[model samples]
Target: MTNAGAEGEPPLDAESLAFLNRPGLTRLWAAARTRLERGGLQPTGTIRLQNLDAQEREALSLLLARPVTGPTATIRLPDLDIRLRASAVGRGLAATLAELGPPLTDRRAARNAAQAERIRLWSAAETTLAATPLAGQPWARPWLEEIRRGGTLTRQPSGTALTTVTQAIDTLATLFPGTTPGPAPATWGRGELATRTTGSAHGLDDGTLLARLVLRGIAAARGADVPTDAPGRRALWRRASVIPDEVSSTVLTYGLRPRGGTWGEKTLRERADRALETHLTLRELRTLRLNMPPGTRVHVCENPRVVEAAADAGCTAPLVCTSGSATTVVLTLLDALATAGCAFAYHGDFDWTGIALANRIMERYRAEPWRMTAADYEYLATRAELHGTPSLPLAGPQVAAVWDAELAPIMEAFGVALHEECALEPLLGDLE
Candidate 1:
């Protein structure tokens, strides 16, 4: 292996170093050093210089004491060693170059050492995985492959990648907390897990290596592409029953009068009486005494504007609006409502992505269509056309509207997207 040279070696005298560092002779010495490192310390083979400018040719001629006339110059390794030993450098080319530039390195030896280390690290990793619940699982293979191919472990700041591998695997095992097969266990918060596992509450913060590593395993097990956006990442964490950010990730509501006296419930009641929208954070959802009381109707929309418009119109009914992509917290609230036997009706934009979101929401929450039908889309598009409003081309991958099969085909044929804001009138009318 090559080492950093200057630390242990005695400094070469300035005059001996100056000869190798001359401006015109710089490239010549570099080529010579490259040959030594790749070929090993003992000088052999030849160094070739191509496209020599006037200054380099003059310097070469001066050093060799022979008139050099070609565009290319070649120096035999043994000949140069003998030449340098006889010069003021007073050492062979290996020692001379070592003194002048970075230390001499054996490229082949370094490569062999690196390959051996990688094998050792991966073996150690497999052994560690074997000790966990993930042992012998098919999904574990993908997790192992992801880290190995992505160099996740090797990129660690210290030898801690292995130690981190252990910590991360242990943390991941506990992620699917209810796997014990009975009444499901209570879900864990990120801070609680981080504090217990890492001795620091912030240890699993987003973008932290530990969080990213754990997420890779989750993605691998799900056979899904690793999520790149915050919403996608947080959604993956939620699958393991981890609430990423209870206080920040929230569901927006208007006119929800859950009878619970808890702060979250009371806030909703107050906001509704005053005809205002309330943002219900995931943290509050845990403490709320009332959430979609049995037989109550719950309306879900894709945009916040519909909720705001409902509040403005003094429509006092249970309404939830997923501000954009329905987040983990939004799903949490919906899960709570579903458990309480609330009826669900969902609506979103008529775009491809919106249809996809609607599919998940309706299927998971058993929601009926809330003016989110093909007829609704056709009406909106025709109205816009009459008003001279251009239809925006649908973007993103096509998603089947499982709730209404005809919806996607019509949207595809129309080749335009109609957002919920365009349908605000009827949605608000329904709430009223």
Candidate 2:
């Protein structure tokens, strides 16, 4: 039997070896080549060949030194290996197949190498993320999982996309306070921040990998929903006090006095005896150092009309108006004041969005809810409805006044809206 060949047995004649390399053995060689490419071609395997011509059957019959019993038959790998060796072919069947068939690329090994590369890339990114301050934050785990599942760094893949994302994460980590001594407070434009951190001015532009990564981190840190559009993204950056753009953003103020010799101070110093309306552009805000004396109070209002009324009534109290839903400009001014040890008392309209804005402003600046309580809403709302004070219906879904938990239910129950102007006499009365 072909399998009975002893170890180190002399191989068959040279003519037999020459015949094995001929095209006659092509069909069997193709089968062996298929298995080798899939993985290592093992001994003692069977390959089923179909629709074999007379020549091919005769070739197999000769190679195995057995009768070719059927047009299609199972080829045991071990039988083929032993026969090839005993026939004085190259060392074994696999070696002969390589010579007779197209070169094998070892697809299984290629796949394994690709998988290993992917694991290595992810491990590197995770290691960097773990070492950063954002690692343990509320947003880290889900963000990391997204990276893993997507198989590419960030939402889109570019040549440096992974590196860009990692840099953004590291940069965002700098935004939080650390165990060590902290850096002095500083604010920057998005381009300036990108240039300083990643050495590219536009590295954190909208739709960029760095922007996407940092946005996710900020959303997690601030407990804000992830933003999708340009306006939403700009608003998020503004929340972080990172200006999206300078010229377009402005905050309104009156009765502000900072201890400095700048436009903000100069303007206020000139109008020392009376309140002066000032529109502080973001560009101007960046240059001014707000260092109000401790215990100073800065009243924040949701509407410009409140500031106007305060000014009109000769109210000397420092007032800031958000103008609408507080923009980044408003938050920036408020944050600076808050940092300078200025106490804030925030008042807004008695509506759903109004309560929400108050909650955000209060939470961010630690502002006292000025007349923003359930009792306040009930009093103002009841008075408005009774006095025939024409007002918009309390529109939008109800929002909880987290500062005063009882406020939301009272407002929802009243179903009538009241604005700060509605309580103008009382609000101005307190301002003086």
Candidate 3:
């Protein structure tokens, strides 16, 4: 035979054999090889392998029958020493491909079961509560807020719960006299108690209790002989007939009264209470000047003493005093004025807190910030001797975006707090 080779002999060229046997090329190819057997076919533009050597390329060619069109491809090696193709080779890949596993199915089933249970519980609770008397009452607002804030009537100390429940029972008894006292548990769960209490106390289902309370309130208002126990429905109806449409009309008229009148002294007080109750409008002074017939000039003060001092000085301007934290009266008055299309010019302390309060009043009632600008602060800075040292750097959560941005900065710069009453002389002069 020629020197070509013996039977079944391997390739004998040293360089060629060494090149074919190069570990770097094999290692690189092995590392770069993305085993996408468990994954879907790669998208068209994805890079499949990086840093290919000549031998690796030849090996890949011999293995692959067709050109690789994507990041991953299947290959069949018939003649090479190695046989490799994209196949589910291990438990991991097989598990993924078959899409079956007890753990996964169990987890999903558990989650679904939990959701179903929650829905069942919520529905049951809602159904039970819907039949009660307290349904759709305003008491739910604060109760809901308390619940959101992690309050529980049950968790309340026995003394407190007893007190509250006693009051509720007394109120209910007054409304539903001769009605059997329902099972009142000492410590019911929050949702359970809310549902039960609302239904029983508010008379939402029968409304006999509600009718009784209404009659009692009306009788009490009119100085009539009222029953201590639940008043008869017919008696309530008779009393209700006096006002005819009292429920809707009374609330609507009460709400509208503040915004309707000529900001008179008595009317101002009524509106002040309403605004305070509704809007929480607080101010130091409220001044009303009488310039024209039925004239309405009202000034609000942050300090009661300022109003008192103004009055002492024989200042005829009608005033309302906020006292602090704008009581219900102050807000009601403000709302009344606002409803009547009366424009308000507000002044407050020059400190950060005052700025915040002034901005709040302005925002809530659409009142104008009178002399609450940086310019105003700057002018006031010249008049008042800074005292009490700048308060611990204010925790400024929100600032009026519309007013001068410089206002906050100037307060920070001046490092002083000035109350509205301190600058009252100037503000009062402006009214003139």
Model 3 C-alpha lDDT per residue in residues 1-432, reported as the tens digit of each score: 012222244323444334334543354233222322212312112224545555556555544334433434433212111222132111121122122111112344555665565445434434433444433433322332333244333444444433443334333333333222222224233223324545442332223433333344334433456555322332333342321221211101111122333544445446434432112211211234222223354555565555545544444444545555553445655665665555666666666666666667777766666677788877777565455333433355435425678887777776666777667776656544
lDDT of each: 0.78, 0.75, 0.43
Better of 1 and 2 by TM-score: 1
Candidate 3: minimum summed lDDT over ten consecutive residues — where? 246-255
RMSD for each of the candidates: 10.6, 17.2, 17.7
Model 1 Cα lDDT, one tens digit per residue, 270-386 = 888999988877667766766556699989999988887887789977898887777777887787878877888999988887888888898888899999887888888889989
Model 2 TM-score, all chains together:
0.49
**Candidate 1: which pairs clash?**
none
Candidate order by decreasing TM-score:
1, 2, 3
Backbone steric clashes in candidate 2, count: 2
lDDT of 2: 0.75
Local lDDT at 255 for model 2: 81
Candidate 1 positional error at 4, Å: 14
- Reference-based TM-score of each model: 0.57, 0.49, 0.39
